[model samples]
Target: MALVTGGSVAGPGAVEAARWWMRMMRDPLATYGALGRRYGDTVRVPFGVGRALYVLSRPEHAEHVLVANQDNYVKAFTYRPLRAVIGEGLLTSEGDTWRRHRRVVGPVFAQRHVVGFAPQIVETAVAAVERWPDGVMLDAAGELRRLTLDVVGRALFGSELAGEAGRTGRSLETLQRGAVIGTFLPGATAKRGLYQRVPGLGGAIGQLDGLVQRVIRGSSGGELLNLLREGGEFSDAELRDEVLTLLLAGHETTAASLAWTFVLLSRYPAARERLEGEVDEVLGGRDPRADDVDRLPWTRAVLSEAMRIYPPAWTIERDAVDGDDIAGVRVPAGSTIAVPPYLLHRNTDIWPNPEGFQPERFMGEQQRHRYAYLPFGGGRRICVGAGFAMLEAILVLATVSRTHRLDLAPGVPVRGRAEITLRPAGPVPMRVSRR
Candidate 1:
């Protein structure tokens, strides 16, 4: 390991670069972890065509890139494959389009308005848990996906999406895998049309399209769909893209968070017991409301800790449009900056016992850096569904934790799949037992 200071950047040597690229393509998380350990937080790797990628994991680095100097950057070209699938939706769109979509779509996910969806979120979770037979092994990841899909369907779109969860989940897996593979290919940007020509990629896009159409046609006229339709800001094709983007983004991240929470709790019985105690004391056998989120600090802490360990939106990237400096690292124009939460959250310098699961970090009024924990990213382009996500996670965790506990099935060692989102690699089989 070496110390990086002053204006000079640090990274792998030319001879080591080939090995680094191979490791990155094979397993990005492990590669990034290796880079952090071997070269410190800010490693400047040579990218294609005389470009450099600076992997930044510090909190101040995140603030510098995502907040203060955001105007000098754009969503990196790495997101091109994603833009291919979802079109110019909120997640991949930029400039005037992003601004306009944010303005139109932001109101629906506002804190005050999202609270109104609490009843639906709770009811959906309760219904799903009630159907689980005791002592039977269930896929926690799949169940969470189903539960979240239902919540977004009923609460946001007034549609029943639980039926399509299985197909939708598979479709997302294919698309995400393809997107990641696409990033490493030469001339990946501006090749959206070529993506569909790939064997399985086209079907993945089609599956998502079918789901969006079902939502639009079967929607009992939810506020979001209505706004997208009546606002006249988006054309018909653009309307479908926006709806599909919300459907995928709205449910996927929250589902991943809850699934990871369940997995973490299973591994740490004490944390599980403490969480159950906190939920029991706070809710008192009643359904959780929006206000109850604040009262249940431990439950929220458990989730925060889970996110710290495995943030769903684990990586954030930006391309420098102009020369800039991040934490004294010289960044030139056209450079790519990767602010990975996985690395930042696990940085030993910032977090004591970095690998340990300690929910208490979020329980007290302990002071920390502002950009230290960015599960939802930073700046104006932060996740709009953030408020909705936390509320839904707390309520669902409370609702399910009240009556049952999910323990990992014996001999099943869950591995994380770092695709578009950081989630369990395969089905997370867990036994459901009565509390």
Candidate 2:
């Protein structure tokens, strides 16, 4: 297949292309940002001899690849490493396997159904927040991870995971780092057995395996778990895969986004005040219910703006199954295209003052392109847990805002770590004060 020729190539020469590849392996988010700044929205970076990787940041690119002509694209080769770990779960599975998993797992996250979990989410958040001593400096990222894990555990699996969050978080860090590194290795290295032989990854996998087994064996008949067990569709191995996928996907992204939201609120006190004002006026010192989400538009907007700035799933990539013209760019079959939300949200053409933390952008009416703000991706393959995640985030944010305020600890440095998810690189040290 011929490489894409229509778009401006980021690194046209072989030597420059190799440098770009090395930069990508080292820091993908920074590399993508630099490529976008230099090459504009659509950039074709030469991969191998005749192959090219297209970094498309335009909303139209997202619309075409993820929606309009979506059938022509499939998840890219980058997901292979993740697949080896999660097996045939929804996040990595494709074709018939994906269809089957979605069929069984999708309904639980349906808007109406997800609302049922709101009580559990808020309750878990409140309990976790209450445990924090007044005016104590804590790792907001770790705390949020533990809280989200607990919510997902009790709400969906009827198991308690708060105790395991620390180890699970470390395991996930190892897995994500390993997965990214594994992506550059030979195809055979993507195998689960091969990953198991790797030093730290083996223990990480063991921890995750132990967690999944705990959920399966210790299940106390939570609705989602009951459905999965009674459905008679998934075998033991498939059940383990789905459970692990849900556990990780359900908690990790939400935790990261919440941690970022807290950090952003700390940095931008005016935004934080506005959010707290809205939460106070709306809730009046009561825990947030699902129905309260609509009334508290500013809370939702804060979460939206936070996600816009630091999207958990920063990149969405796909490989073309057939050659086609995406807008004006000619993409050949097998071409890999990345429609990164991190770049799209920051595309100056679409978002004015893209670097600013403005929750007002999501308020009132939005006239931008349908694919412009893709915190949850687009098209049929969009995250099934999108509704659930949003509901959980809003409730947790509102619940925390109702009684507590978190500010970045003095002189602490925070940086984004772009791996499987875009989360804070290290602990987000923040002091929590009771409001």
Candidate 3:
């Protein structure tokens, strides 16, 4: 745990900088989690020459960097590799371009309009669940990915993307691996061209490009597609980037959330029983509807608690545009700040019994720091599709739970892979049984 900065030990540096970097490159999620425990909420380590990275997990730190005094921060260089892939899409874009794109696309994800897509979400989930044969082993992660992709495809683009879900998932795996590697390489942002020259990187981008082309060419003329097309605001490339961003962001995180939910429910059977009971009571053996979302408090809480435990979008990073104080940590200009939800959500001070699965924590009225639970992030850049994601998760969980229950394969342990998104490292094999 020696702390090293600028290749020099500070106050008997508990952890060497090179050791931290090695650990980070190997498994960043565990490294960050351990740092939070050993060094409190904010840990600073010099990274790559004179630059430093501040690992800040405190809710106050998140609020300061992402919301209050937010203008002084921008998406950090860590996202540059992603920007190369997704281009200047809403998720990676900055400044006026981000504002313009947000304006053009924001309304469709508004709560009122998002609720309209619940039927499609539920329909897709039900159909996918129906395909699951009882008493058979299946990969819950893959199934949920297919379901969410289909939901986004039909609801947003009016296309059938379930067939492409597996391919898209593979491509994302490659791209996310490349992105994480790029974050540690020096001058990666400036040398994106060189970075792309690396083996397999080009193929990953090509796969994503091909997917976007298919989405554009096979458009079923959905509402969002129509807006992007008829609005006359985006060029062809811009439109492709936006579609790719939505296609990836819209499904991958939701799939991860659902996947983790199943894993947790399998481990905590009592919670699973309560969840099934709630779903049965709420829907009464019928398909879930948009209105039923409000009536299914436990379902929503289960999803909430799942995301709290394994947030799909686990980490949020931004570069300091100016020097300022955050949660009493001295942040210097040009430093990188990492507000990781994985650590924040598990902070013992913020969440009692942090490691335990208790969906009831989200039930009823409970007072807590706002940024402590940012599965979708916080501030203006909070997920544009947060409402859609939440509603989709609730309905899909309810729909699937109503008809079937998934139990993890005996003696199997589910470990998370912290790539661009937090997801099960390997197949989450589970036995499905008709309820």
Candidate 4:
């Protein structure tokens, strides 16, 4: 990394260049793609304030930076803004604080406890399916959001948050969009102020804050929220941080994951038929339970294949704390490295017919590197909720597959957008028919 200083003395173009870099960062895929086409994968957008962004999008680069010499990288400055919003949760905190938070929240997201939540997830999905009207076009993305939100609410806090999810969903959209942009700007009192002034962002934060407080005060289950409340390891502010982080992370990502899964299913009727048959044969119109996840391998594989193509948590970033060598490129200290699952999963070198829908690729044994799939990420800092989210998604998928078949409306284009997560920009219109 070149030391960038005294450029402002040259001209106003330096500052304008910085703003241009920021704009490009706001939507990285398009920016990165264009840059990669122009200057290959390692393109640095010089902000001219000793804070340039080096966007690298490849598997070897990702493996080297995110996992193999992981100690040299810290969460990028971009995470600082998300940290202000969520506090000392697993996603944002650094060093000991992150380690401690992970230790406390980690065990609950382990496979056993995560699988334990499958029953609640299935119940929620079954309940949603029962409400569907035959041949009625539905916003599948929104429906999946509601389902995931409900499951996260019930399974995490033992509360009925479905009623709040609609408002919460809209609010969350504003916050996510704002938070990413906000991360770069130097703000005063990021926790207590700033966002409070933005209309949708502020109002959404308030609503989310209130909910976090309520959950922290009293939760109905032995979920992570209850454990956090009972442990009293954090103060009110700290507790609010973790709760909000979990809510923001746990709900939307899972929702997008399922939404994409259903869309792919709609496009591939043969796959859908196979999936529906499996659900019928195993679950038999009953809701899925923890014990049945193993039997529903195709259901799990369908969701896996969807994520490989359209990962909700599409990108990951880390700022190098020290200079390191990744494959052959020399990364100097303070360089921001990107490991986007979107590109890695689509890498034609690793995945044959990468753009096609092929759940059969996941069948038999996976011979690829564990890091090769990487939807939930990898190593010690990998998503703590990976197991929990998978269990919930599979369970919900099974329950829905067993009870109803949703057909896509004729020729309705599937639109996608990349915010903090990659989501369908518009509704996924599909008609519901009871099984």
Question: Each model's TM-score, in the order given?
Answer: 0.97, 0.98, 0.96, 0.91
Q: Given candidate 3, what's the lDDT at residue 197? A: 73
Deviation from truth (RMSD, Å), model 3: 2.2
lDDT of 4 by residue, 1-435 (tens): 232322221111355556546655577556555555554545455553565566555667778877788888888877766776667777888898887778778888888668777667777887888788887899998888888888888888887778777887887788778877786686465554777787778898788887777666666763777777777787777778787888879999999998899889989999999999998889776667888888988888899999999989887888888877776666567877777788778766689888799998888888886677889887778988988888888888888777788788888888667767888876788898876
Model 2 bad stretches (over 4 Å):
1-11
| Local accuracy of candidate 3 as per-residue lDDT tens digits, 5-28 | 422213114347667778887888
Error of 4 at 356 (Å): 1.4
Question: Which run of 10 residues does model 3 get worst, by summed lDDT?
Answer: 6-15
Candidate 2 lDDT, tens digit per residue, 1-435?
223344434434555768879998889999999988876788888777677788889899899999999899999999998999989898988899899999999999999899999989988998998999999999999999999999999999999999999999999999999988998887776799999999999999999999999999987978888888899999999999999999999999999999999999999999999999999998888899999999989999999999999999999999999998987788889899999999999999989899899999999999999999999998989999999999999999999999999999978888999988999997999999998
Task: State candidate 1's TM-score.
Answer: 0.97
Q: Is candidate 1 or candidate 4 better by TM-score?
A: 1
Which portions of model 3 miss their true places by more than 4 Å?
A: 1-15, 188-196
**What stretches of model 1 exceed 4 Å from their correct place?**
1-7, 188-190
Which one wins by TM-score: 1 or 2? 2
Task: Tell me how candidate 2 scores on lDDT.
Answer: 0.91
Query: Clashing pairs in model 3?
Result: 1-14, 1-15, 2-13, 2-14, 2-15, 3-13, 3-14, 3-15
